[model samples]
Target: MSRSIEYGNLMHDAMRGLIRKVLQDVADHGLPGAHHFFITFDTGHPDAELADWLSDRYPDEMTVVVQHWYDNLEVTDDGFSITLNFGDAPEPLYIPYDAIKTFVDPSVEFGLRFETQDSDAEDDEAEDPAAPAHLPAVKPKGKKLKPDETKSTSDKEDEAGVKDAEIVSLDSFRK
Candidate 1:
């Protein structure tokens, strides 16, 4: 056992693809029936793109509901964009896959918790178990983040000079 094959990273990449497919499908069509999503991301994470007000409102983490009142939902190769209502106003949002921390469709109880860590972590590794589980994304209009999906959250963080992202490992419970 090498204890360093990075299997977790592989799993994270696959999960990101799955999230992309779902978001793309929804962007093209629409939410099927009762299938809404609970997206949680690190608002403080450097890679996120959301509005200033939103960031102020949710500093560390925030979750938004994607059900009936959203518009301009576009999913692209690297990320996605959409406008959501806030206090009777529609605001734009953009989120890269790397920023996502958690994704869940409670209608099916299907959810994913990603790995999050500080700037010192190496090779896009797992999150610190002691840190908060999930949070919100930045700047406004597009695909925002949620749990780990081993999606990378760099470039944006690089621009911001801060560190943030997510993924969850059950390793802590076994020992």
Candidate 2:
């Protein structure tokens, strides 16, 4: 007997759920100890809307930092809302999970990326359709930077020593 491949929309839903949880946690506990988020989203996504000016400004992609000076955060079944200070003006934004492209927390080096999907197809299949129109795209795994690309603190110290030796040579010339 052979088993059929189980490809469904469960993963997509699960990812949405996780994004919801992360937002919920932040809203509840107020970003808990040095954890800020960089959220990138598609501005044209159905569930995403910005002020007319903002939409015009960032027609494609926008990234927002949720760290300090945010207010009026509310989470709902459909989406979440928050007020951000944009250049001395407070703007309210409501973002749906489907619109999110990426969420990164550099403090813990944890990040999540959501696959883009057709909004209409997703809604239709979500309404009791058998299979999702498209499978969730596999997330690309990131490899650590090579040693040559990444310099450790010791390498900085060595460079500092070389600079100090140059300074000593200059002092001897002055003497």
Candidate 3:
């Protein structure tokens, strides 16, 4: 079998690393200026943990805003845990990096989208009992965010002048 480079996975890893680094900085030092994050994730991910109500409300996916108020931000190699307020009710969540679908910081008009597939450990075990199961393989997709995907703006001028986020893809540099 010929070995080939997995550019998709590589790009995804790099993006996730960037998220990790950003979160780590925030965890160490508070969010700077008007900087905040809008993180959307797959609530159904095996490693994802959240309140039952949140799961029931957003069975498939959920978006949490990390601005104005948030707490208990703990970042790990595999995932991060945070507490966010929902209608005055505090909810704690643990989201794995593989579970993240989109991460946007509208303060800087930056964003990232990841397409991922969970690996079946059972299938891997069947093929090689001694082999360790692999984590999800993530594919990166750089796209402009839809209007609804962003935080709502009350200013009509702001809405009308909304800027499309720049797509950052590695494909251009690959060749």
| Better model by lDDT: candidate 1 vs candidate 3 | 3
CA-lDDT, candidates in order:
0.64, 0.59, 0.67
Candidate 2 weakest ten by summed lDDT: 163-172
Over 8-63, each residue of candidate 2 has an lDDT whose tens digit, in order, gives 35666676687788888888888888888767677888888678766665666666
Model 3 agreement with the true structure over 15-126: per-residue lDDT tens digits: 8898999999999998999998868788899999998866765677766778788899999989899998765567799999989877777676577778553555324324
In model 2, what lDDT does residue 104 have? 61
| Local accuracy of candidate 1 as per-residue lDDT tens digits, 31-95 | 99999876776777776778896787567766666877899999987777888776556778887
1 versus 3: better TM-score goes to: 3
What does candidate 3 score on TM? 0.67
Model 2 scores a TM of 0.62
Task: Report the error of model 1 at residue 12, Å.
Answer: 1.1
lDDT of 3: 0.67
- The all-Cα superposition gives candidate 2 an RMSD in Å to the true structure of 15.8
Native-referenced Cα lDDT, model 1: 0.64
The CA lDDT at 49 in model 1 is 79
Stretches of candidate 3 above 4 Å error?
Answer: 117-175
Each candidate structure's TM-score, on Cα atoms with residue i matched to residue i, is: 0.65, 0.62, 0.67
